[model samples]
Target chain A: MLDAAIVLANFVVIPALSYGSLLALGALGVTLVYAVLRFANFAHGDTMSVATMMAIYCTWWLQSLGIDFIRPLPTALLAIPFAALGTVGLLLVIDRLVYRHYRQAKAPPITLVIVSVGVMLILHGLSRMIIGVDEQRFFDGGRFIVSAGEFKEWSGLKEGLAIKSTQVIAIVSAVTLMAYLFYFLQRTRTGKAMRAFADNEELALLSGIRPQKIVTSCWILVAVLAAVSGTVYGLDKVYKPFTYFQLLLPIFAAAVVGGMGSPVGAILGGYLIAFSEIGLTYAFKRVAGHLLPPSWVPDGLLQLISTDYKFAVSFTILVAVLLLRPTGLFRGQAS
Target chain B: MSGRDRVYFVLCLLLIIGVGIFQSWNVALTMINFALISAILSLGLNIQWGFGGLFNVGIMGFVALGGLAVVVVSAPPVEEAWRAGGWRVLSALFVAVLAIGGSLFVWKRWRPKKYGAVSLVVFLTMAFVLYRFLFDPAVLAIEKVNPALSGFLGGFNLPVLLAWPVGGLLAAAAAMMIGHIALGLRSDYLAIATLAIAEVLVAILKHEEWLTRGVKNVTGLPRPVPYEVDLQQSIWFQEWASQLGIDGIEASSLTVKLCYMVLLIIVLALIFTLCQRALNSPWGRMMRAIRDNERAASVMGKDVKRRHLQIFVLGSAVFGIAGAMMTTLDGQFIPSSYQPLRFTFLIWIMVIVGGSGNNWGAVLGGLLIWFLWIQVEPIGLATIDFLTKPLHPTSPLRVHLIDSAAHMRYVMMGLFLLLVLRFRPQGLIPER
Candidate 1:
C-alpha cells in the first residue's frame, strides 16, 4: 500500500499538477487570443517554444558572462521578460504582415484557421531552421528540492513523494500568473473592453472599444503567457520541436474543453485533462492492494491502460465531452 | 483558352524545368512523386473545404490510416504472429464496432427528450465494459508475441500498387464514420473532432506494433520501379548506355527514376482530367453552390449534410491513394514517420499555394512547393557556409550554425505559405 501510494504521488499527482499548470498557461494564451483575435492562433505553440529557446540561449549567455542567478533555479526566469518582448514583437510583425490582410479581407473563421495553419508551418519551419531538430537539454543548475525520501520521513508515512523544484515553481508561478490574469480581465479597463469585444464584437465596437489596441494587447499577453508556459515546461521536461507541434492537439483540447475564451474554464479544463491522462494510465494495483485481501489481490498491476496510450485518454475525454455537452461543462461561449 | 494563356502555361512549365535542371534528377523525380500524392490529397481537401465549405482538419488522420492501409494490404503476413494474436485483435475490433453500433441503436430507440438527462450514462457505462473486455486481452496477446518486433499480425502480401486503392477505401470508410457523427456539428467543433481523431489514429499506428511493426518500421516494400541496383546491372541497358556515350550505371539509374516520374505523371494526368470533368459537371457546380451558401442550398432542397459527406469521403480517398503512392515509392512503411507538418499541413500549403479551386494549380503547387520544401535545406546550408567561410575553421558557432541551417527549410516553407496566403490567396495560377 505504501509502495503504491508513493508511486501514485510521484507519477500521478506531480505530473498532473505540473502538466495542468503547463496546460493552464497554454490555455490562457489560447483563450486570450480567441477573445481578442477571434480566431484560433495555431502558431502559438511554436511561438512558445521559440521564446523558450531564445530565453535558454540568453540564460546560457548570462551564465557564461558570470552573471549567474540564484542557485537551484533556472536562469530562464530572469531572461523570460526579454524573451516575452521579443516574442511579442515577432507575433506583432506576423500579425501586421500576414493576419492583418485576412482581417481586412473579413475572411471567414475557417479561412482564418487556414491562414493560421500557414503561419504555424512558417513558425515550425523557422524554429526548426533556427534551432535544428536535436533535443536540446538546458538542465544544469540543480536537482530535486523536495526529495521523495525526505517527504516520507517528514510525513511519517511509508510512501514518500518526490517533487522537483521546477514543478513547485511551475505550480506557484502558474497560480500567480492566473490570478493576475483573472484580476486583469475582471478589474482593468482594457480587460473589460476585451471581454466586451469577446461577448459582442459588433456591440463592443459600437460602444467605442478600439479593436486594434485590444488585439495588440491580447497578443502581448498571449506572448508573455506562452513564453512563461513554454520556458517553464521546457525546464520541467525538455524542449523538443516536434513535441511542440504534437502538443497542438492537447492544447486545443484544453482550450475547447475549458470553453473557449473563459479563463476559469480553461484552467479547470487543463487540470481535468491532465488528471484524465495521468490517472487513466496509472496502475491501481498498489492503491487497490490496500483495499483488497491478500488472497484477492490481482496478479500484475491493475493499470487501465499503458502509459504510451496517455494521449488517447485526453482524446477520449474530449470526444465524450463534445458528444455529450457540446458547449463544455461551463458553457462559457460559442465553442 | 487563348494563345496567351497557353503561352503562360508553357512559361510556367519552363520555369519548373529550369529549376529542376539545377537540382539532381533524383531530387526532381522525388518532387514529382510528392506532387502527385499531394495533388490527390489537395483534391480530397477541395471536395470538403473547397467544394462543400466543411472544415475537415482530420486530413492527417485519414492520410495516416491510408498509409497504414498500405501496410495492412501489402506486407507479407507474419503467420506466426497472426496465429499468436490475430483472433484476439480481430475480436477487439469487432467488440468496439459492436459497442458503437449498439450505443447508437440504444440512443435512437430511447430518443430521450432531453439530452444528458439519463440515456447518456447508460450508453457510456455499457460502452466502457465492452471496450475494456475487447481491448485489454487483445493488446496483451499481441504483446505476448514479440513485444519488440513483429508483435502484431502482419499484412496480406498483395501487389503493392493495389494498396493505393485499398488505402483510399480505408480512408473513405473512416471518413464516413467520422463525417456521419460530426457533419452536423459547428465547423470549429468538427475541426477539433477531426484533429483529435487524427491524433488517435496516429497513436494507434505507433502503438499497434503487431500490425505495423511499430517503431521498428516496415521497409523494403515492393516497388513498381526497378531497383536501382537491378537497373545498373541489366546487360541491354549497359550496351544501350555505352552506345549513347553515357555511363551505363548512371544512365540506367536515371532511367529507372524517369520511369517512376512517367508513371506519376500519368497518374496525375488521369486524376487531373477526372477532376476537370467533375468540376464542369452539374454535380460539381452544385457542390460549389452549396459551399458558397449551405443554408440557401439546403433550402433549395439539396441535402447539405449528405453532400458534405460525399465530398469529405471523396477528398479523403484521394489523400489515401496519395499516401499509398508515397509508401510504395519509399518501398517502406514507417508508422512513426508521419508528422502533421510534413504530411498534413505541408500538403495544405501546396494546395493553397497552387490554387485551391483549380486542379492544375493544385498539381503545380504540389510540385513547386515540394521542390522548395526539399531545396530550402540546401539553400540555407549553402548561404550559412558562404557567410561563415571566412570564420575560424574550428569555430563552434560555425558548426552549430551550419547544423542549424537544416531547420531553415521549415521556417522558409512556413514563411512562403504565409506570404502566399497573404499576397496571393488565389495562387499564382488562379482557377479559371
Candidate 2:
C-alpha cells in the first residue's frame, strides 16, 4: 500500500501539481485578457514564448556577468524581474501598435480575436528569428531536491521519488504570485477599478475610473503572469517555441473550463486538466497490485490510453463542460 | 466584376506571366496549382467569415480530414492486414457507437429517472467491456502484420479523383458535428471549440497509425493526372517536345503539370462561379442580413444558429475538397505537416487581404499572397544582404540575418495583415 502511494505520488501527483501551477499562471493571463479585452487572446501563448525568450537571454547575460547569487536556485529566478519589466514594455508596445486601434474603434470581439491572431504570427516569427527553433535548456544550480537513488536509500522503499527543485520552485512561486494577485484584486483600489471596468466598462467609466489606467494595469499584470509562467514552464521542461504554441490549447482549456474570466476557476481548472491528463496516461498496475487481491490483479499495464493522446484529455473535459455548463464550471462575468 | 476587380485580375495575370518568363514554366505551373488550391480554401473560409460572420480557426482539421479521405478512398486495401483483424475492428467501433447511442436514447426516453439511469449505466458498462475485449486484441493483431510495411486496412482502391467529393462530404460531416456543439453560444466559444477540435483531428490522424500510418506517411498516392515518366516514354510526346525545342523530360513534366493545372482550373472555376451566383441570390442577401444584424435576424425568426451551421458545414466541405486536391498534387498523406499557421491563418490572411464577402477577392488574394509567400524569402535575403553590406563579410550578425531570411514572411505577412485590417478592412476588393 505504501509502495502504491509512493508510485502515485511520484508519477502522477507531483508532476500534475507542477504542471497545473504552470497552466494556472498561463490561464490567469488568458482569463484576464478575456475579461478586459472581451476576446480570447490567441497570441497569449506566443507572448509567453517571447517572455520566456527574454528570460532566457537575461539568464545568459547574468551568467556572463558571473552573477550566480542564487546558487541553489536557477539564475532564472533572479532574471525574472528584469524579464517581467521587459515583457511589460513589449506588451505595452504591442497594445499601442495593434490592439489600441481596434479597442478604440469599438470593434466586435471576433474582429479583435482575429487581430490577436495577427499579433500571434508576428510574435511567433520574431521569437523564432531571434532564438531559432530548437529546444534550449537553461536550468542551473541544483537538479533535484531528492534524487531517486537517494530517496530509495533514505526511505528503504522499492518505489523511489525524485523530487525536482524546479518543480518545487514553480509551485511555490506560482502560489506566492497567485496569493499576491488575489490580495491585489480584493484589497487594492486599482484592482477594484480594473474589475469594475471588466465587469461593465460604461459603469466603471461613469464612476470615474480612468479606462486607460485600468487597461494599462491589466496589460501589465498579464505581462507579468506571462513572463513568470513561461519562465517556470521553461525551467520545469525546456524552452521550445513550438511547444509554447501547443500550450495554447491547454491554457485556453483551463481558462474556458474554469470560466473564461474567473481567476479562481482558472486555477482549479488547471489542476483538473493536469490530473486527468496525467492519471489517464499513467499505468496503474502497481497501484492496483497494492489495492486488489492477488487473484483480482490485472495482467495488463492497465493504462487508460496512450500518452500520445494525452492532449485529448483536456479537450474531452472541455467539451463535456461546454455541453453541461456552457458558462464553464464557474459562473463567470460573461455567460 | 468592377473595373478595379478587373485590374486586380490583370495584375495577377501579369505576375504569373512574369514567373513563367523568369523562373521557367515548371515553377509557374507549381505556383498556379498551389495558388488555385489556396483560392479554394480562401473561398471556403470566406463563406464562413465573409458571408456568415462565423469565426472558424479549424481549417487545418477539415483539410486533414479531406487528406485522410484521399488515402482511405484511393489506396488499395491490404488483404493480409484486413484478414487479420479488420472485421473485428469494425465491429468494435460499431458496438461502441451503438452503446453511446443506446444510452443516449434511454436517457432521453426515461427522463433521467432511476431505472433509466441504471439501465444506461449497465448497458454502457457491458458495451464498453465487449468493445475492449474485441478491439484491443484485434488492434494488436492488425498492428503486428507486416509492421514495417502494411500493418492495417488501407482503402477502397477507387480512382483518386473520386476522393475529392468524398473528402468534402467527410469534412461537411465533421463540421456539422463540431458546429452543432459550438454554435448558438458567444462567438469566441466557437473559435475556441473549433481550435480544440482541429488539434484533436490532427492528433487522431497523427497517432492512429492504423488509419494514416502515423508519421511513416502514406506516399505515392495514385494520381488523377498521367505520370511524367509515362509521358516521357511516349513517342508523340518526344516529337512535340522536339518541335517546341524543349527537352523531353522538361516537356513531359510540364505536360503533366498542365494536366493537373487544367483539372484544378476547372474545379476552381466551378467553385468561383457557384459562389458568385450564391452571393447574388436572395439566399446570399439573407445571409448578409443575418451577418449584419444577428439579433434582428433572430427576432425575425430566421433560425440564425441553424443557418450558421449550414454555412459552417458548407465552408468546411470546400476546405476538405481543397485538402484532397492538395494531397493529390503532392501524392502523399503527411499528417504531421498540417500546421495551423500555413493551412489556417495564411488562408485567413488571403481572405482578409483579398477581400472577404467576394469570390474574385479570394482568388486574387490567393494568387498575390501565394506569390509573395513564395518570393518573400528571396526578396528578404537580397534586401538584408544589401542592408548589411557595411558589416564585415563574415560578421555573425550578417550571417544570422541572411540565414533567417525565410522567417521574414511571417513578419511581413503579419504586418501586411495588420496594415490591411487597419486601413482597408474591406480588403482590396470591396463587396458590391
What docking class should model 2 receive? medium
Q: Model 2, B1-432: lDDT tens per residue? A: 899789989988898899899878899999999999999999999999889999898999999999999999999998887889999999999999898888889889985576887887788889878888898888888878898887767899999999999999999999999988888767888788888889899999998877788898898799998898998888988899999999999998999889999999999999988988999998898899999999999898898988999999999999999999999999999999999889999999999999999888888898889988998888899999999999998999999998888788888888889999999999999787
Q: How high is the TM-score of chain A in each model? A: 0.95, 0.98
Residue B331: error of model 1 in Å? 0.5
Using all chains and alpha carbons, the TM-scores for the candidates as numbered come to 0.93, 0.98
Candidate 1 chain A weakest lDDT stretch, 10 residues? A66-75
The most accurate candidate by TM-score is 2
TM-score for candidate 2: 0.98
lDDT of 2 by residue, A110-145 (tens): 889989989998998888888888999999999999
DockQ of each candidate, alpha-carbon based:
0.64, 0.72
